[model samples]
Each structure stands twice: as structure tokens, then as C-alpha cells.
Target: MAGMCCGFVGEGDSSANSRPSRRRNLDMLPFKYIADMTVAPSGTSRKRRQADLSGKKDFESCEGSNGDRGNEKSKKNKNESSKVSENKPSTEGNLEDGEFPKFGVTSVCGRRRDMEDSVSVQTSFYEELFHFFGVFDGHGCSHVATMCKERLHEILKEQINESQENFEWNSTMQQGFARMDDEVQRWNSSSQTVTCRCELQTPHCDAVGSTAVVAVVTPDKIIVSNCGDSRAVLCRNGVAIPLSFDHKPDRPDELIRVEAAGGRVIYWDGPRVLGVLAMSRAIGDNYLKPYVISEPEVTVTERRVEDECLILASDGLWDVVSNETACGVVRMCLKAHMMTSPAESPANNEVTTDGSDQACSDASILLTKLALARHSSDNVSVVVIDLRKDQRPTSNSNYNLIN
Candidate 1:
């Protein structure tokens, strides 16, 4: 077994600022994909992942793609002439002709000063296996989100084994979140060099936390565990099916839960728990204690033949783009992918390492660009997984991923 590096964080990720940013992309109009991305193949089940950093064979793979707004702008300009900007595939990357991209991700700084959002994707994570995709929106700092990127999947894997056949969705997810929260609390309590813009002391640093939305895709089911405002949306038969809901403070049930737990929801511009964090449930934020809990709301959905794709993203995208609209955009991209040639596929398209199905990648890049164009105030991150069974690789394919 190798360590995983499925998560990637943008430099300008999450900002704790609750105020809406009105910054518009007047200059970078009609954005093209400038995301620094390293996409890989999801074909075959038992093959080992390529080593990311200098480490042992039993190491987890964690890959990060860095892209600056300046760099993106410059690159965007050069590629503006070409309808679709393409990056050469990694020499070692492999994908059969016509196989849909297993997943596509795009994360950017948006209007924020620092990057705090993280994305994780792991294919065939276990034997008799399943695939994993997660998005964590870090506020106050990026450590919590980074930690979750590194450990949450491992924690949940243990929980799954502990539960065995009768996997208690709520219980398993709850335990995983609790263990992750504990780890964050310990890390935040210790003395460490601060990296993010929020230069708060240890006492204040304890206030930092992240929103987590994780999806585990098995052979027949999609299980989602969510805390805070991040979300997982399943597109089936062209309709949006929300797998995990945002845990905002103002949500009726969440408001009641916070109040019952001796917390207050005050409107400091927008509804927030105790007029602070906008979301009621999060991974860290030890200062909030029992008020802002870490218990996750879990949803298990059986896979359907009409399934199109699964979308997981941070609030940066969801804040401006509705689930229906996001699904619609993806559907249209997929349709265009089927109809158009690679050269004329999209205005904002990035080539994946394996020359993956551009439909998913195009949709993700477009969504991120849309969020920025709409002046989303936070870091934007999106993952699109093709759910059309026909697009998936056959059982005999053994394509390996390269970092």
C-alpha cells in the first residue's frame, strides 16, 4: 500500500471573510483555462500509483498544482487565440482512446488574498474497491483543510473496516470527522510557524476551521459526508440531486441545532454562528467548542443508469452558481464534447495528463471561470466525475497515472 497525494491546494484558497466581494474580471473577460493542473487516469483497479515525492513504496500520493493570477492572466492571453488551450499529456500517463476522464479538477484564488481550498481524488481506493473525491474549504487558515486532505480518507477507511458489512453511514462518518477534528485541534494547539494571512495568535488560531464535503463512489453507491458549507451534487438524468447540503448557520435545522447547543446565530452582514463563522458545523474551530460541532450529515445514494456526473465543489462556486445551473453547464459541455471536435470543444479547456475526456475538464474550468466572473469572493475548487457507465473504462484496461 502506498501513501496518497490525491489532494491539491491553490495558493489563493479560502478567505474567512464573510462579506461578498464585488470584484469583477473586467480585463480577464471570457476566461480560458489557466489552471495549473496535473490530471491522471482512473482506469484499472489494482495498479500502484506513481510516486509523487521522494518517499517509500508504502507512501500516499499527494499532488499540488500551483497557478498564480498573474500567470493565469498571461497564459490566458496566449491561449485566447485557440478556442481550447491544451497541455501535453505526461509521457507515462495512459488512457484508452475515447475513455471518459475519470475526474477533472480546477482550483483558483479568485478574489481572495491567500489560498485555503483543497481537493482530493483517489481512484479504486480499496480492494473490491471504490473511488474517492473530496473538497475542503479552509477558513482562518489552510492547515485544517490540508490535514483533512492528508488524513480524512485514511480515517474513513478505518471506520469502514470497523463497520464492515453493516456500515453505519452516520456513525462511520461521525467517527471519521471526530478523529480528524481531534487531530486538527492538537495541531492548532502546538506552536508552529504561521503561513496564512490571518496572523492570529495560538488562542485566536484555535478559531480556525474548514468546511469538508467528501464523496465515496463505489461500484453501485455514492456516499457523501459533509460538514460546513462545501457541497456534493449528483447529476442524474440531467437533474441535480444534492447529495450533501451546506451547513450554514441560517438553515432552519442548523439554526435550531446551534441554539439548542447553546450557540447563537447573529447576522453580522450574513447569518453566522455567534456572529462569527458562517457555517454551523466544521472540522476545527476548537474555540467554538460544543456549539460549532464536527458531526457530518451523511447521504448514501445508489448509482443509477441515468447518472450523468457527480460534482463536488467549494462554496466559492456554489455561492454564485446554483446546482441546477452547474449541472446544466456540465450537461451542455458533455453534449458539446460528443458533438464537437477537440479543437473546437470549448473556450476554456485544459488538457489533462492522459488526454482525458475534455468534457469533465471543460466543465470544471468553465465553472471556476464563471465563479470568478460573477465575483465569487472566495477560492474556487471543483471536481467533475463522469458517471455515464458507457464512458468508464472496461475491466481489462490497466492505465497507470503519472504525477
Candidate 2:
């Protein structure tokens, strides 16, 4: 797949200094929306002091033609708006309509410096037998995460276009990942300095990079591709089936790569890889590029009828919740609901659903909350995919894709 043309990196400024201004904009949008729905109080009103002190008065002027009744309605609206803003969508991409069974998905930012660094994508294509879900975790900075969020699907689409043959799944997935890495490198080279905002500039470009774990589900199988410590776990008949393995510095090849790149994997007192980062492979960390690059270890496996669910999460979630515990939560979510497709079943299992279909959304949100409760120090992100829909057969027979 061809990478998108790199954009120019604007003037240099510290992103840290500008973060508060950006967050303030995010905070004010909800406040304005609330105010537009309420009525304004008179200047001599007794509640003016209380309202000003609480900052709730900002929304009171939103009340319209209904007068005092509108004011009361606006009060309810303010409360509801507060609740909605507190509960943002778990995934990053826009939701798709009527593509799959709707599932409630929610996301709550954990106690971290940033609001969120996790992203997810769902798309319906090939008439609903294929589904794509990806979770990217930005560690040092969010550049890598943002790049993946924008380009992953485009890369896949390019690969599919280049390969006219049917279902060369493994090659397609590998090529897609390689293309993603190549794109990142290209991005790095094009910029004078790595920065997220076009208007901001910073001297330190070494700290930006992220971990990626992606899952592509077809009717007959599921393919998982991973880099860094982010993980993917599949639940079959309520049992945990680990699909991706963490790439740590301890692995002989990883150590070799690090050393080859003129970076040393220091073995201090412990056997820990490189004496610092536990993971051997990852997508970003320009400083570590000499020691180890972000080449992903890929795995492809056939799907079973009993396969119930899959969980893709960053280390933040895994650090707090065990693999078994995460699987249990997703399993419970599946059992609580019945699977219903938004469209008619294909004669063959060739159709797929988009990530924003809302089929597995709620479970994704709950998983994020669970990680937060565990007091995870880093940014937390999770993507849950339900495979029960694939287990059920329609008039068409299922076919596995292999190459």
C-alpha cells in the first residue's frame, strides 16, 4: 500500500504548553451546548451569585420561547449534558449506521495525563462476513496513534486493490502492517520535528511512538497483528485464546536487532530486556529505532463456531486486569444480549460490519472502566469484537481464506 503524502511540520513550539488551551476548547463546547438550551436569568436575580459561583449559569441563557418552563427544562438539560460529556465514546472513529447488530460501547478516560490515546475502527464491506477492529496505544506521544487512526484502513484498502486474487489474508495483513511502518518512517523523515499540532513546534521528537494491536475477523478465521506490548485475546466457549504475543527486548532476535541498530540491550542486575522497556518490538520511539524498530509479529488462526469474543487492549488495561478477567467481562456481555444482524445474511459469509455499528460498543466501554478502576497509570483503550454472529449459519455456506 502507498503511504499518504507527508504534510509539512509547521513552526516549532512545545505541545505541552499548548495542551491546556486545546482542552479548554473541548470543555467549553459542551458548556455552550448546554447554555443554548436554557433561558437567561435577569441581572437582578437572587440566584445570580449562586449560578455564577457554580458556573452553571453559563447554560441558563439557553432557555428559549417557553420562558420559566424552558428554564426548568434547561436545568434538566444541563445535568444530562454533563453526564454525556463525562461519558464519551470509547472508540475514535465515526460510527456506521445499520451495518451490524447494535451494541452499546462507552469509554471513560482513566486517571492519566491525557484524555485518551486509544482508537478503534469498524467498517462494513463485501456485501457483512468480515469485520475489522484495531486498538492503538500511544505511549511517549500521540503522533503514531493519530497516524494509525487516519491511515490504517486506507492502507488495507490499497492492499486489497493491488491484490486482485481472492483471500490472500496473511499476505494482505502483513503487507498492510509493513506499509503502516513505512508510512511512519516517511512521516518522521519529512518533518523537521515531530509534532501533533501543525501550529506547534518542539525540539524533542524522540519521545513520540505507540503500540498497535489489530484484529480482522472473517467468517472462517480471525487474523491478529501486533507490535509492542498491546495484546489481543480471543474467547472461545468461554476459554481465553491468546492471539498475539508481546515483543520484548529479551527475545534473542529482538536483542540482536537492538544491538545491530547500535543500541545496547543493557542487562543490569535483572534479566529484564534492555534494563528499561520490557517490550522488544513497537511502532514508535525514534530514540529506540537504533536498538529496536516497530516491526509487528503477526499471527493468523482459523475461527471456531464456539469462538465467542475477542479483546484488544493496551498495557494499561492488561496491567490492571488479567487476561482471564477481561475475557470474563466480554463473555458476560455477549450472553446478556441476542445477536441480530442489521442486514440480510449473505449466501456466503462474505459480508462484514463496520466498527461503529454499536454491536459490541457497550462491552468496550465497560472494559475501559474496569481498567480505570484498577488504577492504571497509563492511557487505557480497549476494543471488543463479538464473533457469535459468525457462528450462526445462513442459507450460504462458510469458506475460509488462506494463502
Candidate 3:
């Protein structure tokens, strides 16, 4: 019922003569977990769920030595760590305005189902300049979303490292997501069998899952990977260029794949796999395994000078806000902020909050507000990354965002 918003802007030296700055806002909006996340044995049937759980014996009797207990403890600690990071707020006051330019992120919990959503922005992973951002929207429960938030980036980095000379960005992204799902599968299996008394209170672990839309901003490119309905849109020259597509069950390719897997695609509200999960791809939902996949579709795009910003958000925002409408609002705010205080000179090349930074941050907040105003039935989360690193407002602020 309560919602909070936080904004951060990465600032750096802006020079008109220097090659275009590598800065880009990678807005990773809301995500849904994998179809095979953690499955309740009877996910497809309410009657079966009751029947299966009632018949299954408790694994508590299987507990053995302190070594097993230690493993349980370690696993619990890992889950806790993930939770803390997912809930970590990137408030303006806490941001360090570090040396490397980074993204400004903002999020809001929509008045939809007890806020089964999690979001994260990490500027410290790997080399500091390589930033990652995402929004994970949980369904059935937030467990899978939280887990992905805590671990996906780390898994991605490890996979990239292991690939070494053979590193192909798209392949690495696909593989990273695959590995992340595998890790989640292992965790779920361990939790069921280990009989950890400490985790009895774990919430949102039923047949719950999440969708992921992630953006990694590197020195030369913006890499986006998406599973499920979440999305990423780049504002190039003020035009909306979608970086990822929603993986709805009815999408022709997705439908074919689901049917090929021996899964039925039936219309229930919207097209659903086996008339269960609405999405064709996700991070969790064990019953939907093989039908709902975790393989993320990846896009690698070069950074451009006319690139205004990037908007990443869950379907809640996209459901109500057209990509063009979202871009227009942000571009307008950025230009206005830059032009508002022409008399004051920028210190170094930084876009001071007193001017454009504040405007940009406000724009991020406005996007979240607009989604809520539209009464989106799903959780709404958004991140806005400023790509025009050094451009300050001049008399031409009114010019169209694109040539």
C-alpha cells in the first residue's frame, strides 16, 4: 500500500570536442521469474496441489549431522543476502556521485497485489564503470524475483569471465540466464530436501516466478536481455527504439515453441501456457518448465551521440505508457532543465542537479507517477538512464530530439 521513489544521476566531464561519452542509462524495468523457478508439484491443478502436499512426507526426519545443518545455514545466509540487496534503496542522499558516469534509477510499487516486486541497480559489480539495472516482478510470490535480483548479475559476470577469448556478448547473455535458472533450480531442490527449520517462514515460494528485463551499460555498448513481459526502450534522437520484446504466450514464435514442448496454449484471460502461466518465458514456475523458458532474448546496440535516454520498466508502466509518450516526457524535462539556468556555468562538465540533473531525476519520478495515474493493475517500476553525457542546454534546447 505504501510506495517510495529514489533517483540517482551519474555525472562526469562533458566535452563537446571529445568523442561521444560512453554514458547510457540502462533502465531494467520490472521482471517476472523463470517458468521453472520453484514449482509446487500441482501447479496446474488446485485440487492436485492439496492432494500432493498432503500426501508428501516431511523431510525434517532426513536431517543428519551438524555439517548438513551448516549447509542449511549457509543457504539461508545466501537467501538473506539476496533479499537485502534487492530491497536496498538507491536514495539520492546515499549516492556517492562517484568518478564514473552511471544511471539514475527510480521505482514505485503499484497498488497491485501486495507488491510482489523487486528492483536493483548495481554500479559496483565488476569494474565500477560497468553498471547493471533491473526490475523483477514476482507472480504467485516474490521469491524467484528476489533470488534473480541478488544473483543474476554475478552469474552473468562469472559466465563472461569463463568464456574468455570466445566471449560473444549475445551468447554470454543467453548462457548467463540459463545458468541463473539452473542455480535457482538447485536452490529450490536443496530447500525442499534439506529440511531447514530456519526457513519455515519463507514467503512467496509457491509456484511463483518472475520476468526479467536487464540492461548492462559497458564502455562501448548497451546489452539488454529480456525474459517474459518486461521491456527496455532506448530514446534515440527522441524516437523510441525498443531494445527488448515482451514474451507473451500468444506471440507466434512463442506459441509454436510451447506447443512443440507438448504444452497447450489456451485463452484464459490472455493466452496462457497449458492455461496456467500467462507468459511464454520466465525465470521460475516449475510446472511450466520446458514450456515457459528462461532463455533471454538479447540486444547489443552501440551508444550514439543523439541517444537521449533509456527507459526500462515492468509491463505496468508499458501497459499504460506508450514508448513514444514516455520518451517525449523525458526529453522535454531534460531540455527544460538544461535551458532553465543558462546564466549559471556548469562546474567541470557535470550536469548539476541544480539544473539538468534535478530535471532528469524528476523526469524519472514522473514516469513512475504516470504509470500509477494510469491505474496499471500490475506492479510499476522504472529506471531512466541519461545518455547525453555532456550536452548542456543551449539556445537549441527546443530542437527535436532526433535529426
**In terms of lDDT, which candidate is strongest?**
1
The TM-score obtained by model 3 is 0.68
Higher-lDDT candidate of 1 and 2: 1
Candidate-wise lDDT, in order:
0.64, 0.51, 0.58
When summed lDDT is taken over every stretch of 10 residues in candidate 2, the lowest stretch is: 64-73
Q: TM-score of each candidate?
A: 0.72, 0.61, 0.68
lDDT of 2 by residue, 159-275 (tens): 765764454656776788778877777776674554354212334444456678877655455678888778899888778888988665667776677777766665543223345
Model 2 residue 245 CA deviation (Å) reads 0.6
The top-ranked prediction according to TM-score is 1
Candidate 3: residue 76 Cα off by (Å): 37
Count of residue pairs whose backbone atoms collide, per candidate: 15, 34, 24
Q: Compared with the true structure, what per-residue lDDT tens digits does model 3 show for residues 1-403?
A: 0111110011011221233321121112222211111122533321111100010121211111000000001111323333322223211111222223324444444443234556665543543335676777667655677778778888987875576454577888899888878877767666454332211234324355788898886545678999988889999986899999989888999989999999988875556777667678888776578888999999988776677788788887887899999998888767665655545633224434322235545666677777767755565666677666545645754565423
Model 1: per-residue lDDT, tens digit, 1-403? 0000011122232333332332233233222222333323466221222111101111111122221000011111223322221221111111221122245677775555556777776544443235567788888777788788878888887776566355466788889999999988887777776665553445537867888998876645678999988899998887899999888788999989899989998876567778777788999888887889999999988777788889999988888899999998888776656555445643223433343446666778788878776767676788888776433223324432111
Model 2 scores a TM of 0.61
Ranking by TM-score: 1, 3, 2
Q: Report the error of model 2 at residue 356, Å.
A: 7.4
Flag regions of model 2 displaced more than 4 Å: 1-106, 125-128, 164-167, 191-206, 251-253, 260-262, 267-278, 338-359, 390-403
